[model samples]
Target: MKPADVIALPFQWGSELRHRKLFHPRGVLMSGRLERTAPEGEGLPLVSGPILGRVSKALGAPGRLPDIGGLAWRMETPEGSGKWDVLLASVMHGPLSRAVLRPILGWTGSEFSTLMPLAHDDELWWLRARITSTIDGGGLALTDIARRASGEGLDVTVEQALKLNEFQPLARLHFDGVVSGEDISFDPVVNEPEHVRLTPQWLTDFRRAAYRRSREGRDAPNRPTPEEAAEAKDS
Candidate 1:
């Protein structure tokens, strides 16, 4: 068996025993829109539209226990041909620090980042997001953010950087509604835009193995691939 698959066996068993996600077991879903705001000169992908997202405590901690925050979202490709899934965890925003996931007590004051680099058009990029809208409370919890979203909506700025600390705004993500009890799973390893690949192939393989086992443990169906979607449409 592959090394990654072997390493992921425990997580698969844990999820199966618990009947929940190994990480970020509890979360709330939101419906949002993404508007591209990057300048033309930036090499960032120009994709934007409606999005479905989730915010959660990574360890499923309760009562403000310190835990990693998770922000994952799904959006369609600009060409409408496929879908892309991006998952980020609360972490430092620096080039080096961005690779490590940091535990945070609150969601608003923390920065969420894709710990792995993405290779697009032969260039490496990192995606990050910060909450720009203010919540009446301290926004210490996911429920606080949900309450704020259901009211005036929540605004978050999505930024991308190419191998440096300088990040340019790529899009403005607005969450305006709450989605209840939606059983959705996002696998960036499997659901990515055409020609955009996750870098450090070994790590990608590791994530693929881990995600597959997690899904299997939960008895969750995998999302349709681009080819499957097309075939279904044609049928």
Candidate 2:
């Protein structure tokens, strides 16, 4: 895996918070756009989803946007029918203690916000990101990454000295199957590290919420989530 070279874009926090704005269609649809991308591209295809228009209509805020941050990757390989992709979106990219991180996969915020495709598998994984701290002088930071493995399971890992981004993704992803993007899932409630496996009820509730969002294709109710949509592309 090559080091990610990403620069932060200007981020807005208040907009998404207004009028429960993030829950509005626009917020969901914008997220959906980031979710849909062409696999043939170099890293993140950055494909926009078909429901963007609906989200836009639902979102009356002409200029307001959501507080989004994280990374996206399109794995290069010869194993699956289509290219495998990974997306990590941070709903709350703030500093919090382990107490806060344990529940929502270490995220200090809410919602189901990550989408990643596996080259050798057929399910989509939702992931979360937490910035550990800033490094001395490399425009980098030590970060802890988390994702669910199942409805009651999750996996956690770390990416040392990753580029910091306040708005856009913190880094670019280019892998040659070294970091397998296959059959990955995350569930904070039941998947926390053994020591912290017993998650709180709130975390479990949030997980269920995210699951519903993914299963419903919140932004495009007419379409299936990426996991179910995979067949349309491969078939």
Candidate 3:
């Protein structure tokens, strides 16, 4: 397995985050939403942009991957609620795309989905750290300091600490948000609790992309090409 793959295995296996509805009859709501609000910015943080771009290029050529520009959302769920700067650009996962809009589009029979954690403070931080690490090796280290300074006092497990240290950039989504349980609601798709807006055109494009991807999957085989087969045989 590739080095990145080997590193990612632990994260994948150790994670328990799963996608769920905005409201679950069996699930108890956490309280309020965690949030982060930043001054308007055009592109991603300068530190992580180039790094993420480099890694994502391996997944697909430009414009083919999922991109999020200036994503500012307020999530009020059972888990922590906060508004943060989400510079999610070129994510290659379908489920993740679905989760962003799961509350509204979920009942529409959309095939996309994502796994979410009941409490995801650490998970989200790590995900963001992994992305930032690409720009600088000190990504997690910097966060460690911030986490402590914030006084949330959440413990970082040994495994999580280790993952933070060993993480490499596989994706790029810069994040900075404060999480707490406050007046949070998930009904509004755009223009809600604060300075966040998701254009209808953008959502439409995303859905179209998902559809194209699905159609491609149904029409093609994922097998390696003849050249790859030859290389494998020789080895």
> lDDT: which candidate is best?
1
On the 0 to 100 scale, the lDDT of residue 154 in model 1 is 84
Query: Residue-pair clashes per candidate, as listed?
Result: 0, 9, 20
The list of candidate 3 runs beyond 4 A from truth reads: 1-33, 36-87, 90-197, 200-203, 206-221, 228-235
Compose the digit string of candidate 1's lDDT tens values, residues 139-215.
35677878877889988888898876677789888999999867599899998877777889999999999999988
Candidate 3 lDDT, tens digit per residue, 20-121? 111110111121222222222321111212110111111221232221211122233222243232222222233234235221111011121111111122
**Which clashing pairs does model 1 show?**
none
**Please, what are the lDDT tens digits per residue for candidate 2 over residues 73-182?**
33322332333333344443332221121112222233223432212122221233333322122211112111111111221121211112222332222111122232
**Lowest summed lDDT over 10 consecutive residues: which window, candidate 3?**
50-59
Order of all candidates by lDDT, from best down to worst? 1, 2, 3
Superposed model 2: Cα runs more than 4 Å off: 1-67, 71-198, 216-235
lDDT of each: 0.83, 0.27, 0.25
Candidate number with the higher lDDT (2 or 3): 2
Report how far residue 69 has shifted in candidate 1, in Å.
0.5
